[model samples]
Target: MIALIDYGMGNLRSVAKALEAAGAQEVKVTAHAKVIAKAQKLVLPGVGAMNEAIAELKKLKLAEVIKEHIFKKPFLGICLGLQLLFTESEEGGRTLGLGVFEGRVKRFSNKLKVPHMGWNNIRTQNSELRTQKCFALNNIPANAHFYFCHSYYVVPEDKSLIATTTEYGGEFVSSISKDNLFACQFHPEKSQSVGLRLLENFVRL
Candidate 1:
């Protein structure tokens, strides 16, 4: 079963419906930490400010549960879910993040358009994915377009964790992976065929 964590700040229904369409037999969107702990796989999808997201997680006490098991299971984070894994964010005056990875999320420069919306293709960074064999990106064509909607992006201190990158103002971390944890700044759920393929790959994993 996959637990789609609902911290009162995510697009829970769309994520759940996407998982179902991707062949996930069971998916539970819940705020209860116990439900999250017992699930075999976990999906953290979020939208909105990092500060509010963190506050909800803390209020529900799911933050600790997530910090404890994020690396143990097949954990996937989407959009804000990806940003929350970092140490801090500049979205709302340098708000702190979950600190699972050494990085900071920064807003796009005013020189470029704020909130980079619409479709963009990502360049795979992981060596295993170089041959186009990474499980999450399996069968998906190279430089495939994925839907995106965000104003800020993560910058991991350890470049090795970067799975894919996309260029907006410049190149930014588009996706990240380390062991059981995988996350992406793009909305795979909304990326059409390639998007569904990514979700299918995650469910299969």
Candidate 2:
């Protein structure tokens, strides 16, 4: 079973439905602790401001639950979900994150577009999740395209955790992994075929 956490701030229905269409045997969207705790794998999806998301997460007492899941079970975070795994974020006057990864979310300082909303290929930083292999990914080359929509990007202090990277204004962290956890700044659910395969990999794990 795959648990898609309902944090009251994510694109919930879209993500849940996408998981079902992507061959998930059991896909659940909920805020219940027991249901979440029992799942073999969990996914955290978030949208909007970081501070607001953190506040909601804290209110639900799911913060510690999330921490526990990442420590024990396979975990995947998407978009703002990925950012929340960091230590802090500059989204709203420097908000603190879940500190799952040692880093901060930074806003693009470049003169280009603020929110990098479009299709851009991703460059693999390592082979943690097989971004270069055909078994888990198809046609996901060194820089295969994926969908993205965000103003801030995560900056991990440790370079070893970087799984893949992308360029927007300049290169930034596209995806990251640490043991049971795999996170991405891009929305694999909305990225069409390639994205489906990415989600499939997480579900398979």
Candidate 3:
């Protein structure tokens, strides 16, 4: 079973449907810790404020469970879910995050549009993906365009964790991976064929 975490706000149904379409036999959207912990895979997808998401996770006691099982299973984070893995974010203020990775999230410079809402091409960092064997990008075309909609982006302390990058106002961390944890700032559910291939790759992993 694949657990699609529901933290009160997100494109939950879309993600669930996408996962099913990608050939996942079972996909459960839940906040219960036991159900989440026992799932074969975990996917955290969100589209809202970081602080509120964190608060909801804590209220349901799912934060600790996530931190515990994240590295033990195939885990994927999407959008705000990706941002929450960082140490902190500058969304509303200094909102603390899961701290799974040593990094901070910052808003794009005003030079470009604030919320980068559209399709953008993600250029894979060759050496890192080859060395790490990033399964998510496996069988997916190079320079594929994925759907993105966010103002802030992650800045990991280790550049090697960046699996892919996209340029909005200069290049930003579009996707990251470390061990069993894989995350993307873009929304695969809205990305069409290329996105489905990526999700299928993850499911096969």
Best by lDDT: 1
Clashes of each: 0, 0, 0
Task: Give per-residue CA lDDT, model 1, range 1-205, as digits (tens).
Answer: 9999999995689889899999999999988888889999999999999999999999999999998889888999999999999999998798999999999999999998878999999887544332123568778777899999999999999887888888898888888888767899999999988999999989999
Q: Write the per-residue lDDT of candidate 2 for residues 87-128, one digit (tens) a residue.
A: 999888989999988998999987978789999988875433
* lDDT tens digits, residue span 45-111, model 3: 9997888988898999999999999989999999998999999999778899999999999999988
Candidate 3: stretches off by over 4 Å = 126-133
lDDT of 3 at 154: 94
lDDT of each: 0.89, 0.83, 0.88
What count of clashes does model 3 give? 0
- Clash pairs, model 3 backbone: none
Error of 3 at 115 (Å): 0.7
